[model samples]
Target: MTHISTTNPATEETIATYDVMTSDVAFDKIEKCHEAFLEWRTKSHADRAPYLRKIAAALRDNADAFATLMTEETGKLLRDGQTEVKLCAQIFEYTAEHGPEILADEDRKHSGGEKRGMITYAPIGVIYSIQPWNFPVYQPVRVLASNLMAGNGVILKHASICTGSGLMLRDVCMKAGLPEGLFDVVIVDHDTSDAMIENKLVRGVTMTGSDGGGRHIGQVATKNLKKSVLELGSNDAYLVLEDADIELAVKTCVQGRLYNNSETCVSAKRFVVTEAVYDAFTSAFVEQMKAIRLGDPTAEDTQLGPLSSAEQFDTISEQVSKSVEGGAEVLCGGSAPDRTGYYYPATVLANCQPGTPAYDDEIFGPVAAIIKAKDDADAMRIANDSRYGLGGGIFSKDEDKALQLARDHFDTGMVRINSFGAADPNMPFGGVKDSGFGREHGGFGMKEFVNTKAIYLP
Candidate 1:
């Protein structure tokens, strides 16, 4: 079985080759992970932190190489890719720094003098991780670092295009001095993955991908009576009230969408603007979008890279076409670049209707769907109508009012008022509804990989 094959999204050309894991090897790796789980669970969080720190050191030591490889594999800018590695380090370091305290027994006494109780954390065994190509490095590390720190073994089934990222992460773990099988990377296509999910050795599952991917995994995990943590795609709204700063909102919108070539799950998909400043916001947004530099992801000056894969380019292109037909006025950049990889120029749309495909559908490209509303109520209504509720942003001069509106109205799991949000090592990031379930970062992240045990000590 072939484990890997080299391909570039930029030139749409074969770069190299790799091996794939057959079912037999996949099962063996699962078995090893299950066996390794027993030993890994014996260590304390204190013991785990040193290993995590070593992983952090290794990530910093090999930042450039890892970033270059990541850029080659996933078509993110080298700086972005390097930044991902640094975040991966922070995932480990944060878990190492805080996991122990969170997992430590909490001494709580009932005010009614009922009893005293202590809560403890335990390894939940081998977790099946299915990650996407967009965040080839940080996604897996977010789940894996917390899992390892909490004393659980991890079995990664990474994106075929980003198989190298998973392998490289394992190498980093080994370099950090983890025991064999504690963090195993298995290569398997989709169907074979289903088989592994049913395996008794695999006790839990977590995924970071599209809504469809999350739902499919959710079904599998539910049928098998296992746990799952998902970080799915979001048609997250960026609400720009009439009182909003045109410059700040425009700048943040461009930053959010163009970052990752708009391959991010939580990229601001819709722009909900009140009619008062709608034209100014739209003009400023288009101007900024035009200013974004699209070049080889490896280049330092590149602000945007090609879509990570040929398939994604087609889907995004089709989405843009269909959205335009559904009544969105294409303001700029609705076509692919004449380049090697799957390159689409940044696009901006105006006159987007509430029920239009462009309005609710997640824009996974450099396209921003603009939905104009007569008033704040209409803006809120449009923003809250999406089935997806992952992450959202609000821009307004009345920060307090905007926050309250977001808190009360938006259905997303997290909100960034006047700022573009990403996975912060210290914050819990997740989603609701079609965007998937469970959390991937911070305290919630560490808990995802562990089994909680209660001790009643009176």
Candidate 2:
């Protein structure tokens, strides 16, 4: 009789409640997914492409409805919700078009001249995905689209706050001609989720969440001897170098920090500015942050929305308070408003130093920490002084120098020069260090849960 209730963060109203499945019911879903995988793996890549295309069409056809539902469930901007659905559609289209070529067997010449070798990519069994609520549709679709194209079945245990989005996606896939049991959404508690990870049929575990959650899942998967991919939390730094464009840097950095209510893992949480332009960038950034319009997510004029939940709001508020107590300065916003819903303003913290939450922790809300560096070298050094290395950015007028810095100096898995973006379908995404491992976009994701078999011909 366990249940999870969904709420509208903007209105503070309950939307609906869903019953959590018992252990037996959850296992039955897993069994059905495994059975589908057996048949799906036997199909050729060509046969799977059309179904993926159908999924893309279904997403696009129902984008408006799905986007509204996501906004209602997660407090994301309505326009952003629509954009998320479109991005997911693009992922499906990309996987369908390129999956066959990427998964094709590679012809290789053996070290011995007399022998020839070929490497073939083969689909593994069910992949268990545990996703977060920030980018509800895109997050799950990022894993599901690539896995389905690789001929593997997927079972999702999405964040309880967005359970309706997960189930709706499953319904959309089925309506698009996807075979039943191929993709399943399970509603279960934490204990059942851990047991599902240990299930023999789940060959791989992929999760996108906090660093703490990643550690727990990674340990459980390791104990069970299953391959796991974790995309954990990050406090990514966006460096404003001495030779940067001040105007462009200020605008882009603000957008980077406040996008998606600033809940994005790859969003620019820390601003590392060189001494040469630190004053100018900081002034402009604070002014812009203070002017942001925070209101109803459904309103087109509203640039920011409430946090996904009250817990998220409390976490951000506590981090800001601790950072201020540890010697950080509030440039614009530092406290939550006395409002009915879980709303926090776009905040900018200045004079940020090490050992403070503002500088060290990932503030998963609309808060930006600004730090001053002596020069470009110092800025780069400051950016790398973090345990989390998921994503970072560089802003410089010299494209050549920025590209060189990104390639040679940046220590993260993904970096941008003079720009900020969450993800791209054609690029490899993921991170190193405490941010977790495994790449998810481009052609890399299609093979993460696949097996590589080598055959030699002499």
Candidate 3:
């Protein structure tokens, strides 16, 4: 049997190994999940709340262990891992608290009020979730909690690097009163995963990864006539306007970029600075980015952690090299320290023109690309220049102008005004254009895989 081994990216220490399942085994598991869904779909939304609540409690109870495992597996900062655990718990709690209402049957008028109709959101079937390693706990939970509450069984195909986290999540759900086979994590290869997506038992699919991967899976699911929700990658831009407070912009941009070691899909990757404050913002941002020392993720004093894997380290390093070759200037960090683990320092690049990775592609690490804009209008233009529209930010002392820009002109699904955050349960999270379609969180996800059936009464 082929086995997958997980390692601590910070220390390059092997953590655990697990055997991969055959396509047949995975298919059989899907059959079992469909059976569970058959029974689960009979329950009212209220009946599902208790299960989610218990899972949330279990997550909190085991927060430290889960955080430790995440740190060991992906080199996530301990504090960030702990926060991820909390966020996962909150997601479960949020689903439990609000799912019933979100999925509640609604009365409506049809035929110009001549007929009364009731629209019901019904569970489809098994939902196949393809999640990434970056935010392992939260990524799976975003789909799992909502789907379970909506009365669908969920199967998670997490990234190979964080296999343990996926299995551990399944264990927690089972122990927290989730019915057996209702939520399962499959240890299978990509080919098996595609086969599972084409399985009749799986009614829908959700994926979080690169646009390239999203397109492949989305096509497969579409070919199978299955519904799909894809939350893909992004090269999100954060703009510092002429009237912005350089201190806040610098600090928030750094936090946004370095969060999760900058592996996040929605994190700030591009900085568009208006000429008025270009000098101030770039100077402070580069200085602060330089001061962030890469060290042991488990250490409290360490401000920056290693990339998630040796592959990730190499990818970031190469991207930086190519960006510099393509006329981008490394303002702060451009080289990885000779270390035991997959360590890459916080880096900032300027003079980032088009046709470079720093200018157009998503560099999934602690590297920041700075683009100079002629003015505020040019900054917005630069921010919207990318093919990606997952999330972006605008920092201006004018709250009204920032809100207006985010609401009207900012061409992303989500925008943060003068602040930085990964996600909030109360807000919808997803992206547009190359970032992919569909929204998750704030009740949007609960309906993504459900069937909207309209019942009419004459």
Candidate 4:
């Protein structure tokens, strides 16, 4: 038997352990997937729709179990966990309803009547997905929906911490009448990840992780000539102008950071508050950060929870200390909660030097650092100075100014004015520069898994 163990960050206990396949077993699984995909890819889009629908049904039926397991393993709020599960179903359903059309036959004419051309979408072979643990089920669900509908088999190298969640996903897909080998979950360490990439079984790979990890994996994928998409790290900045609505800005910004116990790569890290409104914004932001409840993740009333692991806590804490050393202010919370769990208080550091450790770096835990900007130019400079260009925000009463800030900036991918970092399935989601390479969860997602073949007939 091959499986991995689960750790409860809340209790410092090993809740369960499952087997992880050996190299031989993994290679065999690859063989099975390759065999299955040949027939699976030939199936009509109409045929694929039913399996997608069944997956949605299975997820809805087992939502409770999935949510509980998610909370137990990652220490996120129960509702947040449920949201992830629900989104999983929604993604599958959306694909079922709209995917076939996206892959429909393309009509074209070329060289007058002498020759005619058409564009047809066909499935790529195997897609290797290296996923993160933050969204657990939701993250994989997005990948699964797009790849499966595109008639591609997927080999998921999910995060070790979310091993249990990954198994549940595989089980649900199988129960939905999907072929056994269409999707296989592999629980291998980093070394095996490199091996899988080099195995010649993985045709394309998409990864979401730290910037450094993405670069390494991407290099390997490129070397192997495998198409790759990566959603790496982000240090989003929320620029609040003096004319902005203080109340709405503060509320939305907090949600962006604390949405996943601050584990999200897209969470806002730098609060570039203009000097004129810095005082008021800080006061209200601290008030909101204080009211957040850090109860057990299984509790529905809990708004905030612990980081997924001790290492996450340590990293965030170290960043805060570095910020203070470089002359920063602790607006509200800085240290971890005084108890047993991996709970860190909602830390706020002010007077953080732009481009310093705290302001520019991606903190994958529940801590925020604010920097006061002298003017709009300073705010733009601070926002652009980051090595990362994933997502960002600008809050201003003047619509023109807000739009201008977004346009005249180096912030790549997506930018939400007066809102937080959220990805609607209909919207294209990806980062630029050091953040990541390709898009996910939209029409663009399907392209990653399919071969866009153009045909000529005479």
Q: Which residue pairs in candidate 3 collide?
A: none
- By TM-score, how accurate is candidate 2? 0.99
Model 4's TM-score against the true structure: 0.96
lDDT of 4 by residue, 225-323 (tens): 989999997888888888889998999889987888888877888888998889999999999998888868877688888889877778878888888
lDDT of 2 by residue, 195-249 (tens): 9998888899999999999999999999999999999979999999998999999
Model 3, span 64-125: residue lDDT tens: 99999999999999999999999999999999999999999999999999999999999999
Residue 315 displacement (Å), model 2: 0.4
Model 1, position 263: C-alpha lDDT score: 84
Give the 10-residue window scoring lowest on summed lDDT in candidate 3: 330-339
Off by over 4 Å in 3: none
| lDDT tens per residue, model 1, 1-458 | 55568578877777667677788999999989888889878888888888888988898988888888878887888898888888888888888899888777667666475888777787878999998888888888888888887788999988888878789889988877988888989888788899899999888999888788788988998899989888888888888998998888998999987777788988888998999999899998998888878888887788888988878888888888888887888888888877677888989988876666687677788888888988888888888888888988889889889879878888889899999968898888988888888886767878876767777766
Better by TM-score, candidate 4 or 3: 3
Q: lDDT of each structure?
A: 0.84, 0.93, 0.93, 0.85
Worst 10 residues of 4 by lDDT: 1-10
